[model samples]
Target chain A: MDIIASKLFFTGIDIGSTMSKAAVVDAEGVMLGYVIGPTGAEHRRRANMVMEDVLAKCGVSLDEIAYIISTGYGRVNVPFADKQVTELTCHARGVAALFPDVRTAIDIGGQDAKVLKIKNGKLVDFLTNDKCAAGTGRFLEVAAETLGLELNEMGRISLQSDTPVKINSLCTIFAQQEIIASLSEGKPLPDILAGVYIAIATRVVKLARQLKVEPPVVFTGGVAKNGGMVKAIEAVLGMPVSVPPEPLITGCLGAAILARDEAFKLINRGEYKLQKKQLSEAYIEFTEKTR
Target chain B: MSGYYLGIDIGSVGSKAVVIDGSRIISSAVIPSGTNYATTSAAVKAEVLKLAGLKEGDITASAATGIGGRNAGAGSYHSVILCDARGVNLTFPAARSIIDIGGQGSQLTSINETGQVIDFSVSEICATGSARLLQVVARILQIGIEEIGPLSMKAVRPSNFSTSCTVFLETEVITRISQGDKPADILAGIHRSIAEKISGMARGVALNPEVAVIGGGALDIGLILAIEEKLGMKALVPENPRIIAALGAALIARG
Candidate 1:
């Protein structure tokens, strides 16, 4: 009926290989709430959980949300999503929105890594290494587990190393062995961690170098939170890189922004009823499956 | 009387020693290489000597091979490629190609009719499909490495593991386990993955029959079957697959 008078919100969920993140935004492009957690076995169930969690945090009701966009590896499995967008586009948009001058966006996720070349606030070219997890968060997780350190502590601890050990293995499995061998040799923990960060940074930089990478690079994804990795990357690139405030939510935020834009366009065209009906049907199907 | 010959293979993961009098293996021992290669080499040699009930001085000549071959205190050293070729040929004279999957690496070698290595490809850069990868998977499954082969053989539906990187495979295994996939299926998937990797390495070498699979990984019956399936032909495996390299080393020492 009077759809124009009602306040509309959008939700975006990114069900990554290791973690799932959700973001809620109002029609005006302001982020209201966000939530992130480990992506468990069932991707569909995890997506729904994250959606509910973010909505609850924002004190928003499911009915008030106008659109929901899903991205990442499990994007297609999001039962209640109105649209499924590719993570590459979402990441580029998210980083561009944060840093308008960013020419390159480096996203290192749990299972893969991507390098995007942005020109004039749009993605021009991109390269990805989905074939392996050598430079991704999974590598760091394994390294941290092998070193008996928390994943979050790797960056800080690595900064304390005076003489960083050289990690020659490009494979994550062999890297774990190398790290273990270093530990048994009584090498300093900080040095070993430094080596791990440098190895990952070297891999990411190699991916970035394949493209025409210019300065003003933006780092996104879960791994970007590691200061040691950022420093290592900067050292290799010979340029400073900027990181978003909440690097983990960049993809989800971009998806939410897209959802908000698409919903406003529909509302403006007076086609709100069709969008609402589709979401309700999808939501019903998701509930039935969960039950 | 024929003289005794000693063969020591000080690999990255394990050290193997074989003592042979003439063509018959008198005694053999395998122990973890541990942190100290020299110490493990000495320990393995002593254990082999004890098993044979003979003193070190009784050995006429000794040869070593593997990652720690030079540092293992052997009288002579032979390349792993040469050792693998000679060792497999001794057991299966028709074997023209050998696939070796060790703890830290893997290799596929094609040999001439004379048991000399003609061409070889190694998996040193990535530990995937190596014995160490299986050991890591076993640790994650909380089962012994020996259990993987038997369990995998009973797989009703083996899962497909697309990633060849060992690090990614570990995560894949964890994800599969969490999804309530059967351990047998997971183990079978790992064997198949290893099989595909070894096959890829073998494709570079001109593999001619009889192809023999050796090294610590050959102990896994599931892997042997997978390799056979991948290559579209049967593969020969010696009775004591792990001791082939040591035996080859001993043969080299005899000369």
Candidate 2:
């Protein structure tokens, strides 16, 4: 797959804890294609397959691609990429690419959640909760398993609750017991579910506030799709939140766009000649020591 | 004539009484382990008599099990027996694993072929069990205990409240309420959440297909369904799910 060399096509790959997303962009910041897949068995293997698949679909050939930039927890494993970026940088860049007017970005991923503040498309400061899977996507998945609801359906179910249930505990175990006790006493199901959404949103708000949220703030990541969570967050911040279309794939797209820019720079330097094998080795070395 | 045996299991949250005639369980009783054992025992005795149509002298043998079992005194005797004897045959032969979900915590006990405890596991902390969650639901819904089960089934899309900790879950529930959600759905969500937690332990010991559920929470149909949903298997609720522990103790005494 190849695109005309009129404008450089950058490719960004973000391999997260639960999902992998890839984005391709032109010099003008136009997203070529945003693709996603489950983070498969191994870091490198899944990243390779997903990247190839996404690139193939967009008709963007490896030869046409300028520079490849990898980001996220699994960044080091992008076997064929030229460079790797931190999740913080990638998230800020990804959000800024979409809503350049925004200075604050909050991303809730699978195993970890983060809040970042960006200035002029550069990440200025950020806060991340990597301790447990409590407020992240995994916690909601576990909760969904318990409730016998599909992960996609929780948002809709929460909307039906008439009187929201109140859960004061922040610890997952105690909150479950509190919920169980409430169930035994004959509380409504919707209310209890509503309480749970509120709890998660509260955690997100706390993290966002720590970074000093600015208007034109963007909410990105898998958790942003949860309607109940969004509503709770909106209530807490007293502001309307913006969630990019296909929020999960934004980080990857940003990485891809960055790759395009690097490729143009390589061309300008007349240093665009390197074996794929050498490129892979250098990328791996940088990732191994990026942290 | 069939000799009537009585077994009482006093746990952290509540007490259970099971009356057995030979190999058959005539009836059972379940009451909260509120303030003291005197009142709990008396309440159990009254319930057993009411169900079995017999008085104290009719009970040929009696045994006790659970956390409060040792504390239960018959106005004089103060020794709690293990109640793992191989006497009064269990009515349900498939009940080899006994899970007690009490007020304070939960315990998983492996029962031998003869209804004796082979190994048991208990939660380490002092936390609210199914009873407390039930109370929250009751308070939120303003409905009787009998209503939650039927109403929970009505939810088309059940809310998923996540948590493995009882204390943390309380705060989560409160957050949900503040977010403009209803009480019934929250109750249903809580039921499923706890079922998942309890099932995690049950899965640890290779939960047999015909596992028996015992505890005050088991009385709630919603909780039972939640367990079934999470385990992907049907659960066997004893004649009186809450009293199974006490009844098991009684069976031990009879043997």
Candidate 3:
């Protein structure tokens, strides 16, 4: 028995479509460390390795971690998690932790898009578009490819569209064509960039309306770092949007907090409804009985 | 004597047949492409006959445009025509840019003031402009092609799809769907992608206000909106946009 492993901590892992993230927190809900890795083709296998590496890097042992929670698009694939939470709930909790007064959370992930309405740090209503990646980080990446601009450069370049063309078309393919047409027309590069920003901002605003969009809106996900998009969104909403530091990691942090809470609940009760799956003989007997 | 002409545009995905009496289209028919061009042509012929009714036999001549433009001949050689500057100029005399987007590919032609093909761009590699991509989305979401447009209009928070390439986009769409996005929003993303690609192709061409859009894909409201939004100018779409190319061909034959 290692003494270092005896310390108490809670862990949260978010298995996303493109990447995986892990976070650890103490019993007091104070986050200590975080780690991120690619969620390659082998999702579940990669998740385990990522979690193990995160624990090692954070100088925390598996024995010290009281509970493990999983979140994100691939949450269900996390075999080691004690509980799985929806990205919606986790994003709200994460934003709430960062910005206690945050009433709205806009999370644009790699493969999906989400908008959360938060009241008192709790999720009220949320809208998400997981059917296509037309307006998300992925779409921006694709559009950037046509312009031969790097992902980071798109926001800066988009700020350049002089006319600030409106791309009302909801489809990514149509948008691509429209962009090509603009390029052929010799429209200034900045104007095209500005147009893209407005399009994305318009999409977010449209979704934000579905939920009660109150001020003090917090933006998360990889797209939050796009200053052009941020300004565009602000201009559309006619208000300042707050962005949490490390917005992408908030989901993992929230998961860690929840894990810490679970651990504390178990410590005080001294009685964990033992996860039946942990008992080999009892699990077999239960399965046999059910069958 | 005022003479009328008929035009037939048989493309890979669909067929458009139109009868032009001077500048106005007397009748038009749009039908899906079956197994082969012959079958599709036959279908178009039947549909045209049905639409033209009494005027069907009176059509003095006919022309063909698009991929099968060279071979779209009925029994009569005097009635047949092919896609060219003369064909396009017959109907859209002032057209500066003629955009044709069908199910399989897209064509962008720049016509000078004299109604000549000055420069043109074609997209044959990327499946972005094809209906196959939309078809895949519809199948996965269990919706029809027509539903994609209206559903996309309802997207509160539309999803973003990167990758103008069709194969890559299909994977992205699947990932989004599994992530729990609305199908309508997803469809919107697909439309935007196509518009972006088409817009890129036309980037360098000096755009003339008298733009003419003719293709089967023109029926998709989402795609048209994307073009309009990006160009920042309203383009004229004939009543039956899909049959415009055919009308242009027929008008040429009438001459």
Candidate 4:
């Protein structure tokens, strides 16, 4: 966190559409520390803040981290990253590290949803709903707000319903209307909440089905923390789905692991050089077009 | 059975009712659709009947349309698209194309000379290009929906939005506000994006001349102007645009 921050460490920064996260790993890809927070309006500044927060939490100094890799939609905005890897690739590596046999991985993040096909631990091919909010965290957030309930409360509450209502709208806003209509129709709150998750699961599972989902499927991303999503997705997929212990940190951990691999690979070739990154809030000039 | 005919459109955002005696529309009512569609339907129906100086017993037949059409307590419900074509033709005899942009979505219907449907298309649920976003923006900006049109008209250079998704556009507007952009400029940008999306959807159908724009979205002058600019032509609007589908329902009831 400070100038004298020393020791050999690698880091991964994932500045996603909604949340910005950072993870630090030792030479063996063991996570030393990580930080997660809302991306807020200013991502460039948030990127530097997340990196410093993770390092501070780990008691590591700025100079101790040997390499840093950035991923996710806002990856390009991380000035301190030694390299930028696509989130899908990072996800594949991260999930493989967690579940070695995972052949399919689906991540429903804040704005976009993706289904990644993996071979062993590397990404094969993928499909994404990046341009829309049909089956993503945004859908759940909208539903939560409409129901006048906390976002975290929905998952557990949805488990109580035996009959989830049918939701037809795929658009997040239109789906909110459907939720309202369901509320008006005297549908139980649990049923409506369960239906919301089912709607998202239906869309994402449909995407997964398009790829002929191989078993050992793992789900990650912040949305994976929701129990309702896990249940709905499993039901829709007609197969069990596994979630990592800390699903939200997988992308950043993957980046950290990738950084470690990259650092070691470079050291073996006598090409290991730490990127000179000053983690400071000095550059506030370019907030525009950062996203 | 020959007293008067009534048509009610219980839409997602609003419920509208039209009362007609013979071929002439006597009165109409528009009200916000609250949590209960049936409740709002009754209110709208009562208001229209009262405005027309008629009682429930005087109504010969009634029909309903829109998303909550079935709950309107009418004789029967008709498809909104069919009602739209019928209503728009009645409002504007020369109109061969109808662009109905509601609160939550948009629809484009092309009709024949005799008011028979030729072809029609509905915008994707996410691609509504409707007033729903405007209402949200208005709330975020702490202004009335009525103020958006005049407020957006003052922008010298409208902010150029990069995304079409309403959620992303909303974030963009917030970002712009934080960056010290004027509300007018941001509103102009929002209108531009909405117009671009609506016009794009309209183009997917067999667009014909004398295009009539209706529904809650037509009430936004800024959106209407921007849509006209995007389509490169003037769009005709009725005096009361929200009840086009209701009028169509009324005509169907009359028959």
Calculate the i-RMS of every candidate, to one decimal place.
4.0, 12.9, 10.6, 2.8
Q: Record all residue pairs in model 1 with backbone atoms less than 3 Å apart, i.e. clashing.
A: none
Chain B TM-score of every predicted model: 0.95, 0.80, 0.83, 0.95
Summed backbone clashes in each candidate are 0, 72, 68, 2
> How do the candidates rank by lDDT, highest first?
4, 1, 3, 2
Give the alpha-carbon lDDT of every model.
0.84, 0.69, 0.71, 0.85
* Candidate 2 docking DockQ: 0.07
**Using Cα atoms with residue i matched to residue i, what is each candidate's TM-score against the true structure?**
0.76, 0.57, 0.56, 0.77
- Which runs in model 1 stand beyond 4 Å of their true positions? A1-8, A56-61, A96-103, A118-124, A142-150, A162-192, A209-215, A278-291, B1-64, B68-77, B85-97, B109-144, B154-212, B230-240, B246-255
lDDT of 4 by residue, B95-179 (tens): 9999898877888899987778888888774744877888877876779988998999998889988877787666667667756
Docking quality category of candidate 3 according to DockQ thresholds: incorrect
DockQ of 1: 0.31
Looking at model 1 chain B, which ten-residue stretch has the lowest summed lDDT?
A: B32-41
Candidate ranking (DockQ, best to worst): 4, 1, 2, 3
Which residue ranges in model 2 land beyond 4 Å of their true spot?
Answer: A1-4, A269-291, B1-255
- For the record, the alpha-carbon RMSD of candidate 3 to the native fold, in angstroms, is 15.8
Query: What lDDT tens digits, residue by residue, belong to model 4 across residues A1-291?
Result: 122122358899998878989999876677898999988656789899999899999998876777899998788879778999999888888898889899999999998889999996989999998677879898898888777889888999999988999999757888888887787687899999999999999999999989999999999988899999899999999999999988988899899999989866765554443333342231111111121
What is the TM-score (0 to 1) of candidate 4? 0.77
